[model samples]
Target: MKFYISTLGEFDIKVDGQSILRDSNRMYRIYKLFEYFLTFRNKKLLPETIIDNLLSDSESEDPKNMLRTQIFRLRKIINALIPKGELPEKYMNLNFTNGYYCLEIGENTIVDIDVFENLIQKGDKEREYDIESAIESYQNAISLYKGLYLSDNAYEVWLVPTRNYYQRLFLKTLNKYIDLLKRNEENEKIVNLCEKSLLIEPFEESIHIELIEALLKIGQNKSAMQHYEYALNMLEKELDAKPSAKFINYINIIQNYTSRNNDLDIEAINKSLEEELPEGAMYCSLEYFKFLFNLQKRKSKRNNEYDYLLSIMINSNNNKSINDVFSVLKKSLRKGDVFTSWNDNQILVMLHNVKENGTETIKERLTDNLINYTRINRNEIRLIFQPVSMENTIL
Candidate 1:
């Protein structure tokens, strides 16, 4: 009998290459219990710890009895899937000894997560000496991580630490692999790997930077800028933060790659003339927004005044139009504040002379007003603040 367990993305169990878990007749709790034991395999877990970890917030008062019942059911499920008389009494059984429960793995059992960790360990060791073998190992390991560990177990506190650990490891391995590829000047391979990596880690700003650089190296400037815009919008909306200084500088370098204009004043004057000047909360194009952003940078430098940029985005699932949200913003912002459309789904507001604390007040008031006036859910709106510094430039 062969038992294979997969805990990434979905929790699945296969016996003799046949899936035993089904959608309509799913045993969610039993599966979760089995997963918990498998996760802490070979460890002595107290009944209280298992109950707290697996059955927390439940209405059941007799958790120990409940756990015993579930364990019995899990064993039944496992036995039904496997051939009779295949293993000894101890093998392929959830065992209890000395008031501790453990999943006693049989010799034939293979867990995807276990294989994944082993491959990662192998890749790390081989990466020191053999690049190709390490890359292969990493690729195999990453493929097994189809998505987050037990993605269906989102909000399960016990899973968070392990999930985060694997996610970080995956990213570290990916970055190392990309670096090795870069050493070989494998630009196309870099592009493929980065795109695949972004599927698993879309919000990884470092990967976005690498993707942009890889695209640029292959004369894909248009694609690179599109990805930059995406990274900027995503980071701002999701994290309320900007890309790192290195990422911003790299973008600037890409833009000015062929420029011969060493004169700063001439470039500044030209840029200023090209921007659509806004007195207060006026709508403008993204291009104009960039120009105004630079203008604000200069102003902050000259007057040593603190300012902040706030981005408002309407969730696509909402029925509110861009103009509808813009109307609310125009009425809500102060007279010195300038606003522009960053994208069809996003609005950029430069809140002038306001400290970080002031931005909080503004956000609160804006949230209240928008909720009071609009039929949209509060979650359908996203507001991101970009703090300004004279020493740095932002887009």
Candidate 2:
């Protein structure tokens, strides 16, 4: 497939048209710098701005030499793609005006994003014109998306706009795809698509609200209400904002029918969880635990868990600083294990799995681990351990 990097205006490098070894880190950086340039194609992105965009907070001294090396490598890659004899003249024809390399491929270029956007827009019209054509466009749009538009780096100014633009385009295409599916009476397919969209873009309040709407359209009011509440709560907690007026209106409509929005099927899970709570497992106050666990279960990457767990831990410990407890837990986990100091003075150790008698060994290992960790800080952080098993051991 041809590799087209849209810098100034979106340059095309047809690989099938030419070949080059394009795996240098510098080449990738230039690709990114060009990407940023493409997003703000009309504006002249400066070299210093590109350097600042590329550097991390930890990066020292603006590496001009490094950047120069990358630009050279990018030029070499472009040159290597040209035929040996006709290269110099054809390349000289390209522009590098005012420190910004440009790509003036008019409309014939097969850019994945451009193709996706065009097909998505045409898909919408095709829905009106012809069902077969619309389906074809949606398929084409989905195919061209590749992955998230420049999902490599978010902090890079170049990557961010390109990422956001492509992301918005991807979602637009996805919504159009869902709309087409809905028109075809493929409600089941739409439900799955809505679910996947919500997963990919949980921050998208509209999509969640749409999910609820779609669920309700299929008479799945029970599940619909659950999603509506989840979506609203997510917006409130993460964004510190209320649900949109449209969503509130949706909720009001749902409530008017039969208080269906308030009805929840949490009793079953609660009952199971309660049964697991031993005779005196100290399940005193658990709202925060439930919230943290739910958030982690849904999306493990949410950093709010750390603050939430710390808050609960500090609050429960008679306002005493539970910093040692937090430190011990944080240091104990290898990489992907979840351990939370949710209860003040109460530290819960979460391990993936241990051998049959490994729980006992793990308990001792944990105690030793905490002692070693706690002593270094010289803080009084005596913690209790509660191992809550999800699907295996009962109370």
Winner by TM-score: 1
| Per-prediction TM-score to the true structure, in the order listed | 0.64, 0.53
Error of 2 at 284 (Å): 24
Candidate 1, 212: how far from true, in Å? 0.6
- List residue ranges in candidate 2 displaced over 4 A: 4-28, 37-67, 80-100, 104-109, 142-148, 158-162, 255-395
Positional deviation of residue 383's Cα in model 2 after best superposition, in angstroms: 17
Best by lDDT: 1
The number of residue pairs in model 2 that clash at the backbone is: 3
Model 2 lowest lDDT segment of ten = 276-285
Per-model C-alpha RMSD: 12.2, 12.4
For residue 261, give model 2's deviation from the true position in Å: 14
lDDT of 1 by residue, 11-67 (tens): 888876788786654688888888788778878889999988988777987988888
